[model samples]
Target: MIAAVNDETNLVEKERKIDAIRWNQAEELSTFDYFDINALLAYLVKVNIVARWTRLDDKQGREMLHRLMTSLDGKDLINKQ
Candidate 1:
């Protein structure tokens, strides 16, 4: 009765929160992922995420990040595909 109603309310609120999170992630990518290292770092800190990199040429940097990210099974990068 009352408990059942409360459960449904909680579930709906949880769903709304999840949707908001997905929206925020998409927005962040559009805003930051195409930029320089400092922009990426700022976005990461703001979103409470993490990243790692090495001193390499642009091509090497892309290859290394792509390799590491794929090895992570799409864990924590912009292109999580």
Candidate 2:
């Protein structure tokens, strides 16, 4: 009985926080660099494929993904040359 009431209260609190965040629209309007995001996603997918067929540990995979993302500079990231 108490647990249910507590859960409902928590839910309402979370909903109120979300509502406040929605009203605070100034912070949410910034654009993301989708091209870099996509490139990072592609590299992650390739890593996953290779991992499925071989031994790629979590730590090494994360490090490699981080390195790949940081290496994506604006200079011909998509082979624009």
Candidate 3:
């Protein structure tokens, strides 16, 4: 499981790098800057999606997911309490 997760993560990283390159190329060709807030938000969304999809059976991934959920729950509890 760890191996599989590692492989998936590596692949995702590669894809991200490729995507970045493509984005840069497109921006260059179109004479546009790729540093806008909307672009950043879109990049973050893409990263999260990739992380979730490539998590596989990784213990670290599970832990991260748990931590994120816990943090959100804590925020909800504080808001409601």
The candidate maximizing TM-score is 3
Tens-place lDDT digits, model 1, residues 8-76: 556645543443454355445555345677556544443332122233235544554564355335345
Q: Model 3, 1-81: lDDT tens per residue?
A: 233344555675655455445444443453332457654554455446436544653664555456445633546546765
- The deviation in Å at residue 15 for candidate 3 is 0.2
Off by over 4 Å in 3: 1-9, 32-81
Clash tally for model 2: 0
- Which residue pairs collide in model 1, if any? none
Estimate TM-scores for all models.
0.29, 0.27, 0.30
TM-score result, candidate 1:
0.29
lDDT of 3 at 74: 47
Q: State the lDDT at 26 in candidate 3.
A: 42
The clash number for model 1 is 0
Q: Give the clash count for model 3.
A: 0
Name model 2 segments beyond 4 Å from true: 1-35, 55-80
Estimate every model's Cα lDDT from 0 to 1.
0.44, 0.44, 0.49
Query: For every candidate structure, what is the RMSD over all alpha carbons to the true structure, in angstroms?
Result: 13.4, 14.1, 11.9
Candidate 1's displacement at residue 16, Å, is 0.2
TM-score of 3: 0.30
The CA-based lDDT of model 2 is what? 0.44
lDDT of 3 at 6: 46
